[model samples]
Target: MTSSNTTDTATARREDPPTTAKKKRSRELIIAQLIGQVALLLAIPVLTRLLSPAEMGIYQTGLSVALILQPLATLRRELLIPFAGVRDARKHRWIGLGFAATLSGAIALVALPAWALGNATLAETLLATALILPSFALMYVENAFLIRHSAQGRLAVRNLVGGVLSAGLQVVAALILPGAIAIAAALLLGRAAATFVTVARRTPSSDVESPGEKKSQRSISAILSAMIAAASSQAVVIVSFASLGPSAAAQVAVGQRVAGAPASLIGQALTQIALSSAAPLIREQRPGMTSQLRSLTIRTGAAAAVTAAALMIGGPLLAVPILGPGWEVAGVMTAVFAVPLSLTLVALPATTLLIPLGRERLLVSLQTVRLVAIVAAIVVSSALTQDVFTTSIVTAAVWTLAYVPLMTAAFTATVAHDRLCAQVVNQSSAP
Candidate 1:
C-alpha cells in the first residue's frame, strides 16, 4: 500500500500544472529569444554598410555551409536538454557539459580543413567560422537544458547577454575595421564571448557516470540518432538557400528573416516558457495546452497578415531609400513571405507535441522529405528559369505555405496515437 501511494505521489507531482514559478520561467525564455533576434535585426544595417555585397555574399554562404556542419558536430545532444523531464538537474548538467565539450571538439576538427584552404575568401570564412562555430554549437545544450529545467528567465538572460554583446561588438568592429572579413571575424569573436559567459556561469561543472563507465554518458547510437533527426529537420530551408546563388538566396533569406523576426522574437520567449511548462501539460493531457496553441496560432497569423499587408503596399516606397533602388524587391518579398512565416507560431508549438510523445524519429522523417522536396523544387525551377530570384520566390512560397499544414498534421497524428495507447492502458487497468 505504501509503495503504491509513493508511486501515485510521484506521478501526481510530475503531472502538476505550470506553477507560478514555471510561468515566470516561460516569460523569461520568450523574452531572451526576442531580445537576441532584435539584436540581430538591428545589427544588419550597420554590418551591411561596413561590408560590400560580394563580401556579404561570401560570409552568408559560409554561414550556410557551417550550419550544415553544426548538427553533425553536436550530434543532437542538445535535444536532450529539453527532454530533461525524465532526469534530474545533476544528470542533465553532466550530460549537457559532456555533449558541449564533445561537440566543440568535433566542430574544431571539421573546421580545420576549411581554415587551411588557400583561397582568400575561403580562408576568411574559415577564420570567421573557427571563432563562431564552437560557440554556437556549445550554446545549444545550455539553451536546451535551461528550457527543460524551467529556467526560462535565466535562458533569456543568457541569450540576451549573448546577442546584445555580440551585436555591440560587431557594430564597434565595423566602425573601426570597416571591411567584410574584419567585420565578420569580429562578429564571430563577439558571439563566442557572449555564449561562453552565459553557459559557463549557468551550467554546473560536473560529469555524469555512464552505465558502462564509458567516457560519454550517452551511447554513440543514441547520440547519432538524435543528430540525424535534427540534421534532417534543419536541412530543408538551409540547404534550399545554399542551392540558390548567394545574392538571390540572400534576398529571400532577408524577407524570411523580416517576416519571422517579430513572431520569432515573441515565440522564442514563449518557446522557453512553453517547453518548461509543457511536460506536465502533456502528462496530464491538459486542455490548456491545446488552448494555448490555438491562441498562439491565431495571434501569430493575424499579426503576420497585418505585417504582410503593410509590407506589400508600403514595402517599395519605404525600402527604396533605406535599402537602395534595386532592393525594392526585398520589401515585396518580405510581404509575400511574412504571412507564411507567421504560421510558424502555430507550427512550432504543435511540433513540440512530438518531443513529449517520443515521435522524434517520425518528425525527422517528415523533415527529410521536406528538405528533398525543397532541393528538387529549387533545382527544377533553376533549370527552367536561369534567374535565381524567380527560383527563390517560387521555392520560398511553397515552403512558407507548407510549414503550418505539415506540422499540424504531424502533431495531430501524434496526439491520436497517444490517445489510443492511453485508452488501451485504461481498459487494461479496469477492475
Candidate 2:
C-alpha cells in the first residue's frame, strides 16, 4: 500500500505545474531585459525635457543609421553564436571577429568623405559610431554565451549593471550637453562599458581558428536569408530617413521606442531566451517543446495587450507634461503605435525558429515581405499626407497586419518540422 501511495505521490508531483515548470533561465533573462528596456523608457521622458524635438529627432536619426551599420559590420559574428557549436564553422568565432575589425576600419574610411563634404558634425558622430560597431557585435556574443551556458545569474547581473550604467550616463549627458552627438556618445559609452565587462574577459586563445570541413550551423540558403533579412531591417530606417526627412523619421523612431516597449522588451527577451531554452529541446528530440513555445507566445501576447492599453491611455498624459508641451506630438504618436507593437509579441517569438530550425530562408522571405510593407507605407504616407505622425501610424499598422500572418506561418512550420524530426528519430532508432 505504501509503495502504491509513493507511486501515486510521484505521479502527482510530476503533473503539478509548479514542480514541472520553473522557467528559471527565462525568468533571469526577462528580469535582465526588463531593466535595460525600462531604462530606455524612463530615458525618453527625461531626454525630451533636456533636448528639443529637433535635437531628439537628430539623435534618433543618427542612432537609426548606426543601428543598421552595426549589424552589417558583424553579420557573420552574430551568426557565429549558434554556429559556435557546429564543427564545420570551426575557428569561425575568431575569424569573424577579425572580419568585424576590418569592416569597421573600412566603414571609417568610407565615412571620411563626410568631413571633406563639409558635414563635419555628422561625420564625427558617424566616425564614433563606426568605432562603436565592433562593441555591439561583441556584446551580442557575450549575451549569447551566457545563454549557451545557462549562466542566468551572470546574465541577469550583467544586464542590470549595463542598463543602470547606460541610463545614468544618458541622464548626465542630456543634462550637461543637449545634442544629437552627446546622446550618441552617451549611448556608445554605455555599450562599451557593457562590452568591457562581458566580452573583453574572454582570452584571445579561445577564439583560435580551426581548419577542417566547411560544416555550418545553417546552410548557405539559411545564411543568405539571415543576411538579407538583417540588411532589410537596417535598410528600413535608412529608407525612412530618405523618404520622411529627419523630423518625421525621428517621430517614427521615438514613437516606436516609447510605444513598442512591450514588444521590444518582452518580445525580444523571449526570443533571446528561446535561443538558450528551446534550441536544446529541439536538438534533444524533445516532444511538445514547440507547442510550449507557442503557448508561451500566446501568454506573452496577452500580457503585451495589457501593456499596450496602459501605454496608449497613460503614455500621452505622462509624456506631454514630462517631455514638455512642444513635443506633445511625439507622445501622441507613441500612444498610437502601441497597439501594433502589442501584436509583435507573436512575431518575435515566432522568429526564434529561424535560428534553431535553420529556417533562415523562411525568415528572409517573411521579413522581405515585412520590409516592403513598412517602406511602402512610409513612402506612400509621407508623400501623400506629408505628416510624420500619419506616416508613422500607417507604417506601424502595416507591420502589425503583415506580421500576424507571417508569425502564424512560421509557428506552424516550426511545429510541423519538429514533429516530423521527432518521428524520424523514433523510426531510425527503432532499427
Candidate 3:
C-alpha cells in the first residue's frame, strides 16, 4: 500500500471513536426525550379527566409562573459550564445555588402582597415558585455539569427517572387532592429527587482539572434573554387567564402542550446534542462548525415543519378524544399555535450559539422585542375581540411575523461570524 493511503487509514482510525461516541450520545439523548414525552402524553389524559378546566388552568398558571421565574433563580449560569474549565464550572454550580436562594427569598417577599390583597391563587403561585426554584436550579446545574463531562448516559438516566417519577406522582396527586398546589408540590419533589440522584451518581473522574478560564461578562445578558424568552412563550396563557378567564387560559395551555409537544421533544433532544458537540468546535474554531450548525438547522426545521403540518390537520380532530370533553376549543387553538411553535423550533438550535459568538447583546435585544410584540398582540386582541380564539389567532400571527425576520437575522449573523472565524484561523496558519 502507498504511504499516503496508509496515513489516511491511520487518521481515520483515530477519528472513529469520537464520531462513534457522539452518535451513541445523540441516540441516548433522543431516547431520553422520547421517554419524557411519552410520560407527559400519558399523564395528560388522566390529569384532564381528574381536574376541571378551571382547576387545570390554575395548575398551568402555576407552571407558567414557575418557568418564568426559574431563569431568574438560575441566572443561566449553567449554560456557561460547557465553555468553562472544570474549576470554573464547579464555581458556577455553587454560584447558581446562591442565586437561587436569593431569588427564592425575594419571591417569598413578593407573595406577601398577593396574600395581603386576598389574591389566593397569585399568592400560592409565588409561594410555589419559592419552593420549587432552588431544586430546579440545582437540577439544571447538575445536568450542565453532566454535559460538560460528556456523561450523556447519566443525563439520560436522570431525565428518564425524573420524568416517569414526576408523572406518577402527579397522577397520585390528582387522585387524592386534585388541586393545582398538590400537583405543583409533586413537581418540586420530582426535581429534588432528580438533583439528589444526579449528585449521588457523580464520578470523581468527571472532576479532572483543566486550564483556567476568564469569567464571562454575558451572564446577566443570558439570564435576561432567557427570562424574556420564557415569559414571551408563556404570555398567551397568562394573559388569557387574566383577561378572558380560566376557560380561555385552559384552552391555550392545553393547546400549547399538545400541539407543541412533538416540536418541543425533538428540539430539546437536538439542543442537548448541539450543546455538547458543537460548543467545543466553536470554542476551538474547529473546521465544519458552520456545517454542523447548518445541518442541525435543516434537520430540526424539517422535523418542526412536518410536526406542525400534522398538528394543524389532526390536532383538532384528536383533541376531544385525547383530552376528553369541553376541550374542543383547545383543538382549534392548537391549530392556531402550530405555526409560531414551528418557527420557534426552527430557531431553537441556533440560540446556544449566541453566547459563544459573543452575540449576547443581540440575543437580549431580540428576546426583548419578541416579548414586547407578543404582549402588544395580546393587549390589542383583548381590547378588540376579547374572544379566546381571536386572541390566539392574533397572537400566533404576530409571533410568526416577529420571529421569522428576527430569526433570519440571527441565522445570518451566526453564519457570518463563523466565516469570519475561519478567515482568522486561515490567516494565522498561513506560511
Compare the candidates by lDDT and give the number of the best one.
Answer: 3
Question: After superposing candidate 2, which stretches have Cα over 4 Å from the reference?
Answer: 1-3, 10-22, 86-92, 198-215, 218-248, 428-431
Q: Can you rank all candidates by TM-score, best first?
A: 3, 2, 1
- Estimate the TM-score of every prediction: 0.74, 0.83, 0.90
Clashes (candidate 3): 0
Off by over 4 Å in 3: 1-15, 200-214
Candidate 2 clashes: the total is 2
What digit string (tens of lDDT, one per residue) describes model 1 on residues 106-201?
544665675667455555555454445555565665677655544555667777877777778878877887654565566566666665565533
Q: Which is the winner by lDDT between candidate 1 and candidate 3? A: 3
lDDT of 3 by residue, 149-230 (tens): 8778878887777777878888999999997767767876876786677653446876665433334657788788888988
Worst 10 residues of 3 by lDDT: 208-217
Error of 2 at 122 (Å): 3.7
Write down the lDDT that model 1 would get.
0.57
**Local distance difference test scores for all models:** 0.57, 0.65, 0.77
Give the C-alpha lDDT of model 2.
Answer: 0.65
Q: Give the number of the best model, judged by TM-score.
A: 3
Q: What ranking emerges by lDDT with the best candidate at the front?
A: 3, 2, 1
TM-score of 3: 0.90
lDDT of 2 by residue, 164-268 (tens): 777788889989988766766676678668756764234455355333212455545444554554444444445655665555555556766777667766555
